[model samples]
Target chain A: MKIGYLGPEASFTHHAVKGAFSDEEHVPYTTIPDCLEGLITAQIDRAVVPLENALEGSVPITVDYLYHDADVHITAELVSPIQQHLMVHPENESRWEDVGRILSHSHAIAQCHKYLYYRFRGRALETSTSTAAAAKYVSEHPEENSAAIGNSLAAHTYGLKIVEHNIHDYHFNHTRFVVLSRNPILDELRLESEAEKTTLMVTLPSDDRPGNLHQVLSAFSWRQLNLSKIESRPLKTGLGNYFFIIDVEQSFEGVLIKGAIDELEALGCTVKVLGSYKKYSIVQK
Target chain B: MKIGYLGPEASFTHHAVKGAFSDEEHVPYTTIPDCLEGLITAQIDRAVVPLENALEGSVPITVDYLYHDADVHITAELVSPIQQHLMVHPENESRWEDVGRILSHSHAIAQCHKYLYYRFRGRALETSTSTAAAAKYVSEHPEENSAAIGNSLAAHTYGLKIVEHNIHDYHFNHTRFVVLSRNPILDELRLESEAEKTTLMVTLPSDDRPGNLHQVLSAFSWRQLNLSKIESRPLKTGLGNYFFIIDVEQSFEGVLIKGAIDELEALGCTVKVLGSYKKYSIVQK
Candidate 1:
């Protein structure tokens, strides 16, 4: 089996792919769209992408692409704890004050905002395509007098030294990654012990009426189906127009899920089931 | 009266501040937190900040700050059309092929991703604190062979030449701004012709039960109180814990809105009314 992920190498997505599929052949794509496109073109069998961060909420590009650009189905989900480290070139000797710049992806920089503001008050901060790319750059150009915030895997991959470990502001930072494939996974391939989840993309009728969304939710509420998440995204047609993406904590095999969709359609909502899959949680050691 | 907005001048927030307050004494704050702090300290009578963008969804920092960090109330809302331009130093004679780098705020760069990828395929892209700051940097360092993605206001303020106008990927780009103040505006001070909106911050009972959110929404559904927007934000306590921010289509003074809140509180949810204000929409010239 082959897997595609967002990378330069040793990025969080790279870690996720390794954690979920231990011995698979993995290819790295530079951008989220590229990874999805590779999957569509059969360049890779599956693609793992970050869906949301516990601290940062959601990854907009991933969500927007899945909703608007691609015709992929989510086959499975995984959660990985994010541990960012401050790394430097192994041969360089520099104190915090001697460093002139720091580099990482924008989200990683934001996650460590408090520490960055206090320790490196006046240093220039730059963003790279990925944290591992930052590590690779620092490793290649040792004279830059810079450090990168990335994972221990990146430090090992790029031959850098870890100056500090778990430097994020919050201790409970974790990112959720979803595996997307061209076809839905078979029931026999799913792990029986894992919890089942179904995701739906819904749009209300064009009429500007009261309780339009209320009626949609009532379909699930009346059936006692639990909703795990609900988010609104702009339809991109104009301002004040939006569609809701909902996640229900149930499998699609039962009558309840199908009936709820049928009921919603009757209430003038456009509903599409994105996927029904099992969720896997991985704890990093 | 005095107003504070995110600025080094010629920013989108600056335009919002000017549009809302024509002749008021205006001050510029370096960050969103600083602008909110100015209002809390009575340094300014009111502050205007970006809440959400049509393309980008929501500004997390602004939403998080308003929810967790600051003790402020929103008094009015405004929407402004966003127009991005490709600007260069007037005296520099460089074609698109000669440009080695592009600069803008991260959101602006992301908004023009297609254009950037096609025109300057391998050029280095850098992020500044604000789009206007990128324009200023380009104007001051003409020898760097860099252009900026910003607005006409930024071009005028920094004396840069606009090489291309309206370069955003989408034509319907808009940003929503909210006015914050320490004290709520009196009902008599509001414009009667404007539409009324009441924003609420709600937290469901800590128990993990099916339909907890469903019951909360049912409170409004039964009362036929229309909701314009609903969003979930991490409470920062831990993963999977969230607080919902809801916008209703009517003022709090109405019986239906009040009854809905009473019903939600009865169901063991903590609800707070963030504001009841008039909505404003401004079109750029």
Candidate 2:
């Protein structure tokens, strides 16, 4: 299967694509829109995008893209622990205080929130995608006292040294990525336990249109479907437009899920079932 | 009064401050942390920060700040129409297509989502805060083809011309900014209007613990107090930390509001009433 992912080769999205399909042919796109376009045009069989970062919250573009293209279905999902490493030139003997600026993906900067403020103090921290890009920036701008926060893989790819390792505030810092495809994959990877988590996307008519949301939530509440997260993204194509992404801990086969979806459809709005994935289980400390 | 606002100057936060207290001394800070620091150090009387944008959703940082700082009260609020303008240096003759890159604040890029795809299709749009800052980069790096999205004032300040006007997708796009101060300004703003809005910072015991949120919401649900927003932010200095910022449509005087607060406090978690203020009305479209 040919899989498309957002990247300059080794982004988190690229890693997500690899995690989803091992032997799949990887097609890279510079922008999420291009990756989406490829998916719509059938240039690739499936695509992966970061849905939410523990640090940055929701990926707005990814949510917007899924809403715009109704045909795509999220077939699989994964939450990878994001371990951020600070990389700098090997010969550069710059103290942490001397560093004028640091760079990483915006999410990385957010994950390293406490550490950045405590260690770097008042220095300016900028953002880019893959840690590899930040490493590249550090290499090219060697004269400036700068560093990058990314995975250790980025340091190796761009020939930078690890100034600091695991700078994220939380060890459980994980990014949840989802796989989207035109056709649903039967017998997709699942735990021995049946998948209990399901995701859906819906566009609300208004942002502050008074208890309009309460009405939508009541459909789920009435049926006793537990909502995990409800995120809203502005609809890019139209004014005052928004897409609400909801996650519930229930199966589509159940009465609650079906009834909720039926009520939503009855409201004369579009609702797409993204996928059902078993929530990740980590051994307790 | 001296007012602190989030900025490097000419930022939306600055504009918000101007809208609320035109006669107050405006102090600009580069980051939200800096603004908080200014407040702590008494560098300014109060600060205005974008808490929520009607288009892009919540300003997590501002929300987090209010959540962490128990002493800070939201004294006043203002919601302003946010219209973005494409700006280019006056001396440069770069056509829209000729521009290799577009630069503006991240939120600005998000606001013009439709226009970027439809009008300036394929051009790489980067993120910065001030449009004047983008123009400055273009001015210094004359060979690079870049334009910026900013207010008309920024275009004039940076000696840039308006390439396109009002590029936001939403005709009624607005961002709500909250004025925070060390001491409560409730009594002062109350003379203008008796109806007040209060914002509070809440730290839930667990993010994923089942029914914990329901119990919290039940407080307000039982009393029928209208909740305007429920926003979250990562705690800046704490263990396993996250902050929940909530906006309610009524003052603490209402029995419902007090009951909700009493229940929230009974949960053995931190509940800080940031401040109560006269709810500012948005200009009619």
Candidate 3:
């Protein structure tokens, strides 16, 4: 089977893909939208992309695109702890401080702001398309004085040397990635999951006032449906307009889940069942 | 009166400050934290900074800093319509297509992706410290052949020509700015408000399960207290650990808000009242 991931190989998403789909053929898409578009358009059997990072919050593009464009359902979640490192072309190992510029993806760059400030103060920082791209650039441009911040995999892939290990500022630097497929997976491939989760998008009435959200929550509360995550994204129509993305800690097959969704619909909330999926911790390769 | 705003001048935050404090002395700080620091350190009378945007959800730095670092309280909210424009150095105004790079703050650049994709397909897109900085860069570097995406104020302030107006991809482009002071303002100035709002940060028990949030909402729902916004931000501790930022559409002086906060505390949830302040629509000058 073919699996797609947002990558140039050795990205954190690529690492998650490698950890989860050992037996499958991996396809790399250049961007998140392209990865999702590939899933819905059947370019690949399934697609995996990062959803949220513990320190940085949600990947806005992924969340926004899921609600606005994609016609896919999440089939699985992959959680991996992120560890950023500073790397350079091996020749720069002895004097990495002389590097004129530092490059990495914006998120990775943000994750290491403190390390960069204290260690590489006054150096120019640049954003590449991906952390792997930055690694590749450093690998190719050995004549230039530059370093890259990326994962260990990236350093190995690009034949670069790690100058600093685990340089990310925050300790709990984990990112949650999700697998998307056009239809539900029927256990065709062996994917180990620790728990089950069902995600719902709840849009309150346009004339929604304060207590309206309380009413929405009441539907699930009385039924004892456990919620794992709840987030609000812009409805994109105007200021003060929003729709909540809720994650309930159960499968959609249960009657309680149905009853709660029904109550929400009955109470004038526009409800969309995004997925009922399995959650997995990464098996680091 | 003295006011501090996140800026190098002509930024969206500066616009909000200008609209609200017509007679006050305006001071510009390079970053949000700096503005808040100025407020708390008494270097300025008050600080105005962007809290959230309509198209872009909450400003993470603003949200996280408010919850974690600043000792200031929000006194007033300023909501203003955002209109992004494409501007070029006067020399390149007639031959805008010849511009080699398009620069703006990351958020502004994201807002105009569609416009940039179609209009300046192969141009290098760069991130400046702020939108106003982008305009200033283009204005000062006329020989570099660059364009900037920013507000009309930036173009006017930098003496650049606006090649295109209202270039943001989304229509409901608005930003919510807040005034931060060491203590709550007691209507010392004539700041007209459409409504009163109280912001609370609630940290659920570590062993939180599904229905915990539902019970938390019940405290407000039963009292008929309205909530204008509800968002969950990472506690930066670990995955699955979150704190809810709840915005109630009422002042903290009321018994209803006090009752809800008290109940939440009794339920073993740590609740912090971030602010109870006036919300104002921009009195655009």
Candidate 4:
């Protein structure tokens, strides 16, 4: 099976794909929208893309594209603990202290800003398109004598040596990647999954009505459905028009889930079932 | 009284200040944290900063700073209709096509990406520190023959002429700015605020609990205290941990809102009242 990922081959997303589906054929797309677009267009059998980071919140571009443009459904969720590391090209490992610049994605750099400020005070920070891209750049230009901050997988993939492990500010950094496919996943994705979840988007009527959100939540509330997450994104229609993305902790085939969605639609809400999938956890190496 | 805003000058936040507090002294702080820092340190009586955008959702830096770092209170919310315009220095106004590059803040540029692709496809797009800064750069280097995408305030302040109005992808684009101070707002703001609001931060126990969010909403749902927004941000703890920022459309002085707060506290949830204040809307010029 061909599984595509948001990549320059060594991103956290790429690492997730490698750990979970190493035997499968892998394709890399440059952007999140391109990855999803590839799935809907049948260019790949499955696409793995970052949905949220524990520290950074939702990946807005991914969510926005899914809500506004893409017609793909999530088939499985891969949650990987993110551990940003400081690394240098193998040739520069001994003289890493002489590094003059640090390169990584903006988010990765922000995650380790304090560490950078305290230890690498005088070093310049430059943002690459992705953490993996930073790793690649450092590998290709070892003479520049710069370091890259990224995952250990990046270090291994780009033949670099990690000088520091888990330099992120918080110990709880993790990223959620969702597997998108045009049809329900049929391949035997041999991985351990502890829970099943169904995602839904509920859009309230445009007219501002008091308690409208409460009513929307009530559909699932009374059914005793446990929601793992609920987020509001603007409908892009106006100031008050919002569509709530909800994650219900249950199988999509359940009658209760179907009933709640039916009730929501009955209430003049636009409801879309974005996914019903199992959640998998990847242990950090 | 003195007011601080996220600025260079002529930023949307600065424009909001000028429109609402023409009589007060205005000070410009380069970043949101600096403005809020100025407020907490008593350097300024009030600080105005962007909170959320109708299209882009919440600004992470402002939200993160408030949640994890600042000991500030929101006093008022200023909702402004955002209208991005394509403008050029007066010298190049007639020959805009000759303009080689378009400059603006990253967010502003993303807002008009579609427009730029269709109208100015080959022109280079550069990101300035801020929209107002972009305008200043354009004004300073008219010989460069560049255009900028920013609010009307930037064009007017920089003495440029707007060639295209409302070039943003979404016509419903608006940004929500919150006024922050060390105390509740005391100055006569001299602007029309239609409704009062109370903002609360509710953090569930670290232990994952089913139906906890539903119960939290029930506290307000039963009271019929209309909610304007509910956003979840990671508590900087591990996965599945979140703190909900709820906006109750009511006054701070209300007994019912107080009852809800007590009920939440009784439920063993950590709840903090961020603010109970008014919301003002700014019309586009």
Task: Highest DockQ: give the candidate number.
Answer: 3
Badly placed stretches (over 4 Å) of model 3 are A1-11, A21-49, A54-61, A95-149, A157-159, A184-192, A207-209, A283-285, B1-50, B53-58, B92-110, B113-148, B181-192, B282-285
CA RMSD (A), model 3 = 4.5
- The candidate that wins on TM-score is 1
lDDT of 4 by residue, A8-71 (tens): 7787888889877889999987556556767877889999988775222226657777888778
What is the DockQ of the complex in model 2? 0.19
What tens digits encode model 2's per-residue C-alpha lDDT throughout A154-239?
67667788878888766744566677788755326533233567888875554445445556777777566767676555554443
TM-score for each candidate, following the candidate numbering: 0.82, 0.79, 0.81, 0.79
Residues A21-111, candidate 1: write the lDDT tens digits.
Answer: 8778999865566678789889999998877652222266677678777889988888777788899987665564477799886557766
TM-score of chain B of 2: 0.80
Query: How does candidate 3 score on lDDT?
Result: 0.78
* Order of the predicted models by TM-score, top scorer first: 1, 3, 4, 2
Quantify how close model 1 is to the true structure by its C-alpha RMSD in Å: 4.4
Clashing residue pairs in candidate 3, if any?
A: A210-B226, A210-B227, A226-B210, A227-B210
Residues B1-285 of candidate 4: C-alpha lDDT, one tens digit per residue: 899987668888887888777888999874465577678889999888878752222266577678877888888888887789999999998898778998876557766756886888667877554688789989999899999989898999999999888998667656788888897653346677777888888998655766678778888888888787887777767666788888888887999999999998898899888887878878778
Name the weakest run of 10 consecutive residues (lDDT summed) in model 2 chain A: A276-285
Per residue, candidate 2 scores C-alpha lDDT tens digits across B83-179 of 7888766655556558889886554665576788898887887754344466566656646767888766566556777778898766655666777
Model 1: how far is A101 from its true place, Å? 6.6
- Shift of residue A112 alpha carbon in model 4, Å: 3.2
Indicate the residue-level lDDT of A18 in model 4: 88
